[model samples]
Target: MFLNKNRFFSNTDLIGFALLALLIFVMLPVGLDVFRLNLFGKYLTYAFVAIGLVLCWGAGGILSLGQGVFFGLGGYCMAMFLKLEASSPEATKIQSTPGIPDFMDWNQIAEIPFWWQPFHSLTFSLVAVIIIPVIFAFIIGVAMFRRRVGGVYFAIITQAIAAILTILIIGQQGYTGGVNGITDLRTLKGWDIRTDDAKVILYFVNGGLLFACLFIAQIIRKSKLGRILIAMRDQEDRVRFSGYDVANFKIFVFCAGAAFAAVGGAMFTLQVGFMSPSFVGIVPSIEMVIFCAVGGRLSIIGAVYGALLVNLAKTTFSELFPELWLLGLGGLFIAVVLAFPNGLAGIYKDYVEPRIALIFKRKMHIDEDVSKYDPLEAAAD
Candidate 1:
């Protein structure tokens, strides 16, 4: 049902996908130690959010700046379960409440909250990671899109929601983790997640999940729905007059972005050992948008690279420059936006692809002219 008839993705996309797979799964894993690989794994989680943005903002023209809300929700869901495991009666003998999370105890909560009790089950926690965020997205989508609320208004609303959620998390210190967030997450179903071997395994899991999301994004991009999204992005009135419910489409994509963010959040908690309000706020959400924009939001694969490069620069420059790091990053983002609005993907499209065709021309013995194939060009004729 989801198969594409060789539609959107051409050889260019296939090659892009292959190269990314090789780098994330093969090259990086082999070259870097477990510590460095885990750091990259953290960055890859951000790629999930960036890919979601490709569909929401890039294809559908829905710019949601509150993606961190979903990401944090997902991470917190996973963290809830892990914290329960780590807060077993034996482990929390020091606490007043023998089986409650440390934060809950610190806040003087006497019993595990009913909502949190369900997360003690791994199955429920796993489902909640994706389902909860998607549900929230659905409500927001319906409220906004049904009312024809969009453009910058929608963006502002999402950003405001991120702020509200962050405040809520911090205010409800007993139930949520407050400013420190959920911490000391240990073991997943009795497997020690803090070990070096466990970190490597989790890194691979993160990479595998990223590919799954990327493939799903490609399939959506190449399908009929994807085309409709593009059309709607460009000419909404025309699509609305053509007997399609545009609001539903926007809602679906927005919710889908939330779901992707949820998975990333869950992976982040596993790899980073914590989930905090710091990740669920306005600043991180804006940074997520930066990831999508810098990556060339139109290209899912480019989003992944963008997340890696931006984060790589973040880690490297912050360590080296410390005080000057923010200035450097701001300058870099400004440079990319002003000089190369299309971003890394746009650069490749204009410069790298033509060169590739030139290189292949030498290899093809009887080729007069051959294109790698661009869908938009074909569509114009």
Candidate 2:
């Protein structure tokens, strides 16, 4: 009975999945050029984080301001493995140290750091991409939720963590590639990812992974666990009094959110071909939250659209009106907050979705009326 209730697809799920399929497989591919499609691919990476925020902040009511930290961690882990492969002894003969990365050699570090040694194993890095962020989130969630620390205090702490991590990455120049970040990525498993064909393949792979996450999210949203989260969010004391371990639920959702962000980060590295501290900083972390807010924090499907539209606007405005891009972005955010606090998804739910539902209901009712009234049809049957 539990399994049946948690079954993957509902009526709304089918519609949501179909629209996503049309967008990913048909519309974007047919309409956009290669370069533009690739840019949209980049935007899709952010959608992963935005959707994660939907689970963490929207449903769970845990507003993590340090999601970019997880995203950066995942990207950097992938970048490290690629960087090691790209900087083989044969490739670095020009440098003083033949086997080490160029950045290390440039910064006068003769040997690889102890920490970086593990990234040479691609398998380890792949596991670390998900595991590391999950671990970090677990630690943070346990510490904060157990102590009953939340709201603005939790946000401030996460923001501080983002600032600290960004500074550390910049300060550890030799170890981390410093401000330049881990670049010069060439191939993954001997196949050149820089090629247009590879980009297309990666984009599809990304879309598949995203849909997988979305399905998992839908399952969670429809399950008892998801209800517990919403209950904890709205009435923590009532939940705790009912003998539910509230902290555990918070920690689990937070870690899941972190894991999602990390996958997005890894995908961002693959699609963009670099990972940098710029994305790990306070500004980017806060921007990720905005992506969720603008999408309708409560709507997972809306989150994807929000990320795509916001990034599209950013790219378009930044190119055409470089001087006024920030101003425009600020105004857009202000408008979203003031006019539609629930976001694009809320608007759709309140207005557009009702009309669509009415049409379907009318058709269904007509079919029912015909079956009831047509005595000749019944006799034929």
Candidate 3:
């Protein structure tokens, strides 16, 4: 009887595990196709942004509109390193000539900017991907949280930051690669990105990273810190009066989300082999919020599903009906909000899981009440 109960519980977990495995198996074949693989890779990168937004906005109750800032920081840092590495050694020797970069040449820059000096090494660039975003978030989070600035004010401030960053990158053409951004990346660690093997490896890496993010988010959600975050979300004043430092908690999660966004940005740079200023603009940041909302703002799985679905639709519509793609997307968003305000993930939780569980239970005769024959409860057996 104990064994039977154990099996029943294991079966429940098994179904979820099996579904996840099936998803990975199916994606593998799709990712085998070079074009499809690249597109999926981009989806994973966007999912990363969605995950960060879910944590900050969904759990922490902090609606951050400037995740793009960190995303851009990491992308630009990686792009700068790749650009420097790909540059001809002869180009490096010219200190005062127009050998800084093509955009710099157009801007009449005779030398590399002082700030662009550290991006020469791939290692430094990788470190900066995480460090720069975390540091920036720390400063910004402290400043705003300490002063108790939030709600629409916080959102507007973050949006302004994103706008300013975009303009700065566009204006500083010499150092930032200007409006064109950075491109023409050839190799990553001696592996040709154009080759099939490299593409496959990147696909798996992206998949693994997405799973890791989900797992970590799950752990955080189950932790005490997560509870506090949720409490602050529901009632900040109550949480504060309960002797908790709400600002510190908000800052911690905000920085964590920023770091995750940076990771996504770096991964995106690797897959696309380019970074552009447009990626960190206000529009993209707002889109991140929409992605989370459409996915189920509070659920990590919902975020991933939403990112993949939205991007897939984007790809399909762009190819099939280029002119109407944006309209189609807008209509889809409205439909989701009106039909299922909780998003796709919520729909699954409400309508799908229960049916699945019922089917499984019926198939396994779970409701048969075999306990009626329990030997332990038998009289003088």
Candidate 4:
């Protein structure tokens, strides 16, 4: 059991964590150019959603298809702050409204909206990034889970919510920046984020955030709560009959997942420099699920790799064969489901891990034999 003793991480987990740390912190940064590194940083943002999904869907069996909504909410909150900073009176002197965002001016809004006012303060915006999404998730979780909603029905409801939110943003062009989203994000507290140095710095920052989320996921996975979640997933009726409030457990993990996704969304906006309604829509939400599925939903670290590899492939294939990109993505998902149902981590465990372990075992045996035959040990004997 992953919940054995008080160990938060087993031997395999330590190796996974160390290797991921090396790859994300050292190898990738050292190898890739700033542009490609920044791209991976964006990919890492999705990994946050995947990690949360590992807890929500993998453990708690709470599948949320509208995760992109939380992600977008976080990104928009950050974007609002950045946009406000960039929309200074001095900077937008030529506009009709010299102090407000350009989109507001273009849409004939003479003054800043009251809701946008709070975003001027970076602290408020940063806090809102997490809080706003968590609040949304909490509301949804409570409304659905309390009523015994789960599985496909819950997923559909979330998906519908994502669509509705997307439509609302698109309709409220003046407020939400419509389909184009909040763009021209320039600085973070007067520091220009467009520079190469800032991009690299942000990439490392993104990597750090990812590991933080991963650690939290691992804690939950190894704790009693994690075991409970698993039991609830497999035998919900029995667990509920045992005096546990299944709905409450589901809500907790779901909200936690939303919070993780929101953080990712905020980091994404900081790195990518924009937040659009397109990202808040159903398609992106489903893609986020695909990221989790491909990575091995049961494994937190594997989800990170899944996010990176899938996004990397998307970038590569989209540029090379634009027409076939969607098909390829769909096909990949099908293959993962049909063949390697457990995703990349499952593949590693089933085939790759055993071979590696066998080689290590052989090496250990050889070392023992050599030590026993050593001239010094033999003479002593």
Query: What are the lDDT figures for the candidates, one per model?
Result: 0.91, 0.86, 0.77, 0.89
**lDDT, model 4, position 18:** 99
Clashing pairs in 2: none
Best by the lDDT measure: 1
Tens digits of lDDT, candidate 2, 62-156:
89999999999999999999999899999899999999989999999999988889998989999999999999999999999999888789999
Counted clashes in each candidate structure? 0, 0, 0, 0
Worst 10 residues of 2 by lDDT: 372-381
After superposition on all CA atoms, what RMSD does each candidate show versus the true structure? Answer: 2.6, 6.5, 6.8, 6.8
By TM-score, the better pick of 1 and 2 is 1
lDDT of 1 by residue, 1-381 (tens): 123335566767889999999999999999999899999999999999999999998899999999999999999999999999999999999998898899999999999989988998999999999999999999999999999999999999999999999999999999998999999988999999999999999999999999999989988888788888988999999999999999999999999899999999999999999999999999999899889888887889989999999999999988998988899878877987899776788888878877777887888764746544454643311
> What value does the lDDT take at residue 319 in candidate 3?
93
lDDT of 3 by residue, 1-381 (tens): 546433422343345445654575465455457777777778778888888888888888899899889888877777777776655456445544534665665667767777878987778889999899999999999999999998788899999999999999998777788888987766665566767677667777877777787667766665678778888888999999999999999999898888878888888887888899988999888877777878887777688778878888888889999999989878877877788765776676666766676776789988855343443412111
User: How do the candidates rank by TM-score, highest first?
Assistant: 1, 4, 2, 3
Q: Which TM-score value belongs to model 2?
A: 0.93
TM-score winner among the candidates?
1
Query: How many steric overlaps does candidate 2 have?
Result: 0
**Pairs that collide, model 1:** none
Query: Which pairs clash in model 4?
Result: none
